[model samples]
Target: MVNIDGHTILTGVLAHPIRHSKSPLMHNNSFAKLHLNYVYLAFDALKNQFSDAVRAIRALDMRGINVSMPYKQAIMPYMDHLDETAKLAHAVNTVVNDHGVLTGYTTDGIGFVNSLLNRGIGIKGKNVIIVGAGGAATPISMQTAEEQPKQLLIFNRKNGHSFRNAERNAKLINKSHPGLAKVFDLNDRAKLKAALHDCDIFCDATSVGFGKLKDQSVVTDPSWFHPDMVVYDTVYAPLETCLMDVAKKAHVKHVYNGLGMLLEQGAASFKLWTGKRMPVDYIRKLLLKSK
Candidate 1:
């Protein structure tokens, strides 16, 4: 059981439909392992009530909270400061309240980078392709671009705002590293096939491979994968996603689920709240066993 007292510091994640979050369990277990006087919880809050939720962080003197979905971009206006990555992505996922001042940071990028690092992989000097431009894909794309990859390719449905987001991201990256980033339509199978054949790292940040769309995959053909590429799917549920399975069937050298990204991002937030590194390996094993 979690030890609660007046001195226990409060931390949590704020999002609508939050009952499915694994954050509370992950952080609470980590806290218990370290014997830290911190308690983590999940709060289900709609958009209108978000301002009040931010105020509660100050009123309760809580350490911080993780913002999700609709709140990631919506929660930014209330922050006193935003870390560079948060500003770059134009979204916030982690907020740290120092005294009464709340600062926002986007750790999803760090999580993605560190997850690759954990497996002895780095994006530098490698051709990289990211298949999405939403919340998960945007930061990953921005961060991967920052890592000086040989080239970065972003794919998204051409008809939606996500396609605009892809164009915006490619433009932003091109500003710093001219001609290093490009955008393409996800429906252009010929281009996607060429990118997969040439790219060294392929990441699926889309929602197609999990939840109600668990059976679907952005890359419908398993033959598109090659042995030299590293494949990563940012969906932890049903751990082995269709994309990962497809990569495996093609004999891709590295296949990973999003569990590491989840752990690493939470670890980054944990460090922001408390100035210590999270025991990532232990937490990884714990989560896997529970799964």
Candidate 2:
């Protein structure tokens, strides 16, 4: 039986729409299996309430916090420290609270890489085209660039925030990911189409085809995707995103949503909190079963 004691450690994910998160199941199951005195919860906090949320983490002495969309970047300024990954990505997805001193870290990039490797999809020497340069895309691009891909192309709409982020990321990647990273304007169909043609991997980091943009597709034409390509959409809420549905119609050999990445990042956060290895495969099955 599950029990909560006075000494039990508490953790949760902070997001605007907490109802859609499966992180509680992922973390709580691991805690239960390992017999750890930890309880995971989800807190639905709006953008304006974020500062108070962090303050609660400190005031309540919560063990950790998992951050999500709209707050990843917002939480950075409120954090006491940012790990190297979080600093480089300029975003934080996981936070470890040690005696009220919270340190932020980005597990999204490493999580994405681990998921790809776990699936037997190699990254080295492959050309990758990433769609959008928002929060989800930042760690993904950072991690992918580190894998030494032959080329890393980030496509974002012109005259927008994503374009500015992509431009900054290009300069960031050139530091250690050096010279292989490039940013393209999503408005330039000719450039985007060309990049897609040669890409071995196409990642959708935008929230198109989910939420309010459910009807929109990040890449309208499936013709740009080749049979040799692996299509991944970071939007996992709808389960089958528009891009994944189109990939299915095109008979693409490998297509995936953000589920694996989600699990991987969650696992990383769990380890950071508990200092124990997560049952990755077991958690994968739990999520798949839920789906």
Candidate 3:
């Protein structure tokens, strides 16, 4: 356990249903290994408690906090400033408090891209298909566009705000990288099948594979997947998500859950807060061992 004293700097993650999060383990262990007088914790911030949670960052003189789920977009308004990526994604997953000036950033996209790169999967010159248009999907797609993928396809439900977000995100990506991105309704099975067949990377950024929907998958048909394509799901709770299982059933060689993204994003946040690169290799081994 890390020693807590008057000089210790505090950091944490804020989210509803936050008890299941592994962030504290990843960060606190990293701080311990680096011999830094920092401690990380997880706080369950309900809807009404969010504003006060943000205030506590300043009032308590804490270093920062990682935002997740319902708070990602909600906490942005409380931030003094949003970095370019945070503004681009319209979501803030990591916030650093310099004295009382809180600056927000979106490290999810960077983490997603870096996770793929670390796994020897390059996004450049490849066709990518991503499902959903919420927080995880938006940043992942935006960052994938930054990598100059040959074709970027985003799919979401046709009726909800997510569908509108899908169209909007595609437009934003196209504005900066012309002719690189396109949006489609996820229910269009024919198009989804065709895109999956042709894409090099297929990412499920939806919540279908975890929580109460652990057995559910957005792509029910395993035949849509190809052996040459990499499948990634932004759900790590069950380890082997339904999408991952589907991909494996289809004999896809590289199928992964969201654990890598979680680790990489936490590392990015740690860097922003501590100004030191995390011992990723050691942490990776530690996480795996814990798992």
Candidate 4:
């Protein structure tokens, strides 16, 4: 029986268009199964009211919260502390509130790393190329940078908002990461082409291949992709994004959708809130069944 008492721990997700989120389904089920006295909810807030909504976390005494879309970067200013991942990404997807002291963390990268490891692809000492540097891209970049790759090259559309964001974050991650993250304008096809020459792994951290732009591929030109290269797309909506489609057509040895990354990231937040190791396999089954 669902019960609410004075001791019930409140947790939730914050976003403007939150109804589309399946996070509540994922988190609440996990909570019920784990018997955690946590009730997760979602709050929809407009962009103008974002500041007030962030304040509501502490104002309402919420234990912790997950942030999504438009508010991830905007929410950072309100946070008291930011973990390295958040600092590098300039975004926060998870927030932990301990007696009103909110600490921000970015789990998107952790999820990507965990997903990559499970697929037997190692980022360590490997040259990497990431397309796009927006919301989905940044945290994954920050998280992947920690693995000590040989080098990290990110490309974004020239002078676009994400390219600007990526340019700023490129310096942030390189300060401590051994991989030496580099940012370049995606329009510079020659530069990106050269970077991908020795790339061991290339991940599409952009939404170009899916959503409204499902027909587009970031690397539209036939770029060089070796058989050993691991191709991944952060867009999970169509399962096989245009980038993944091209990779598959080229017979790339390993390819992955963003579903695993999404699950792993969600699992990371679950750990932060409950202090329990996630039932990954079980969660995987649930996600598959949902589809």
Candidate 5:
């Protein structure tokens, strides 16, 4: 771990099944490049153990931690304060601990938005369709809605209380940015097809591509994506997901994976931890060099 005279540098992980996380690689590489003495390690915790895990993190005197998957929302209640983005999305992906006080923040949405804009894909007045309504979906949808998209449609496969939770989130997003959000069932093929036809950007926010599930596919049809469509999948492992492959074969205008988002969010969290602006371009170059 990177160490300063007074600050004992440390890092942590917050994912249910975190054995396969690459965040340690990414962050540690950046730390080495910057000549910091900080070390990041992974911690796996079950759903019910999330609160306990946060307590443990506090006791560890860690500088910061990244929250992933199921624990993003669960860790919210344990935080001392929420940043504006975290409060807006009702989720926290980054946390900074300063002498036992933890402040929560969400960098996922801003990372994604920055990545899209960096690629010159403007969200203003564009129709967007987002697949999945899980932890990642909330921030992406909320931030996209705030960007004033012409329309935003969220599709989820299941129809249980989780679906209702998604609808509630959609309402929260739309309420803040009136008349821009709606939720639908992905099982309704006709509706999904129609949405795809009208969408300028399609995002996959599900865990259909990563780790042991990397071989799984999200969307089955290439025809659903047009040459004008920009497909973005928040899945970096395997580099190219099946949905992205479909987009590429369909000659889509643009396709991006989650690497940029990961980099940006990690930089954001690093800033929160150290109160220092990270060399983002260097991190980006590192990622590219790895490819």
Candidate 6:
């Protein structure tokens, strides 16, 4: 157990390859602001040691952990119970340790929803288009569908496999919320453009704006975005991604980065771990200052 200022505080790490995760900065900063004696770090775990690292989390008396990238799904089996949302998404991003039993949860979905709702962009009765079909997309799509959106559409770049995986995930989401999810092939620009034309919100769930792919953007056409549409990108590093830039230039009503979701989800995980509700405004201000 780690002790800080006589407090036996616990810790967690966002594990992934090339993980310069801002989680440590965001979470540790919050802990400091709240005068809590705790720390959060980042770990670049080797593939073979993933299980070992998770086991160590318990042995070390860690309060909880946040999983990222390749290990989100890989760490599922080690969890004692999965929250309903995590089980549906089949991915666990946050884990809580309750007396050695680690219960898994996915705050990404609800995080994005809370972010949008907090921004006054109502998900209810709005049509949403989510770009990308990877792990990140799963929770976003699943949680968004629960909001009873008028329609939830998913688009992936790769033709066959990507679209298929998205469809399978959509089907799983639809199982809980019937007739609310749809998958589309983005390879066909015409269909993609048509779908965008009818969307009220566009979410970039891909890794198009991070690290080496910072120069890349998923949406190539500006004409597809309208002035009334809201564009939200799940990339926060640059604060403004290429997709967000185009959306702004096009006079989109509300354009936001994933920073809000990041904060809200961290808040959720914090609540799970400590059974205390975090101050949303405090966390938001901290993130803005860091930006």
Backbone clashes for every candidate come to 0, 0, 0, 0, 5, 0
Score each candidate by Cα lDDT: 0.89, 0.89, 0.90, 0.82, 0.82, 0.81
Q: How big is the RMSD of model 6?
A: 2.4
lDDT string for model 2 (57-159, tens) is 9899999999998788989988888999999998999999999899999999988898899889989999998988877899999999989899999999988
Pitting candidate 2 against candidate 4, the one with the higher TM-score is 2
Candidate 4: count of backbone clashes, pairs at least 3 residues apart or interchain:
0
Model 6, runs deviating above 4 Å = 1-6, 17-19, 159-162
List pairs with backbone clashes in candidate 6.
Answer: none
Candidate 4 local lDDT, 1-291, one digit each (tens): 237788889999998667756677778778877778888899999988888888888998998999977678888889899997788788899999999999999998888999988877789999888887776788888777878888889888886877788877688786776439888888887887787778889998876766568898876644466667888988776777888877877778898888889788989999998899767787777777774
Query: Per-residue lDDT of 157-242 in model 3, one digit per residue for the tens?
Result: 89767788888899999999998888888888899998887889999998888778898999888898989889999888888888
What would the per-residue lDDT of candidate 6 be over residues 1-291, giving only the tens digit for each residue? 123665556767656553556677667767776767787878788888887899988898889988877777788999989988888888899988878999989888888899988888788899899987666778988888878889898888665555776888889878878878887777778887888888898999878887778887777667878999989999888888888888887888888988998888888888787677776787687678875
Model 2 ranges with Cα > 4 A deviation = none
Q: If candidate 5 were superposed on the true structure by all CA atoms, what would the RMSD be?
A: 2.3
lDDT of 5 by residue, 102-147 (tens): 9999989888888898788889999999887777888888888888
Error of 5 at 274 (Å): 1.0
**Residue ranges of candidate 1 with Cα displaced over 4 Å:** 47-51
Local accuracy of candidate 1 as per-residue lDDT tens digits, 23-74:
8878998898888999999999987888898899999999999987657878
- Model 2 has an lDDT value of 0.89
Root-mean-square deviation per candidate: 1.8, 1.2, 1.1, 2.5, 2.3, 2.4
**Residue 101 deviation, candidate 4, in Å?**
2.6
- Of the candidates numbered 1 and 4, which has the greater TM-score value? 1
Clashing pairs in 1: none
How far does residue 2 in candidate 3 sit from its true spot (Å)?
A: 1.8
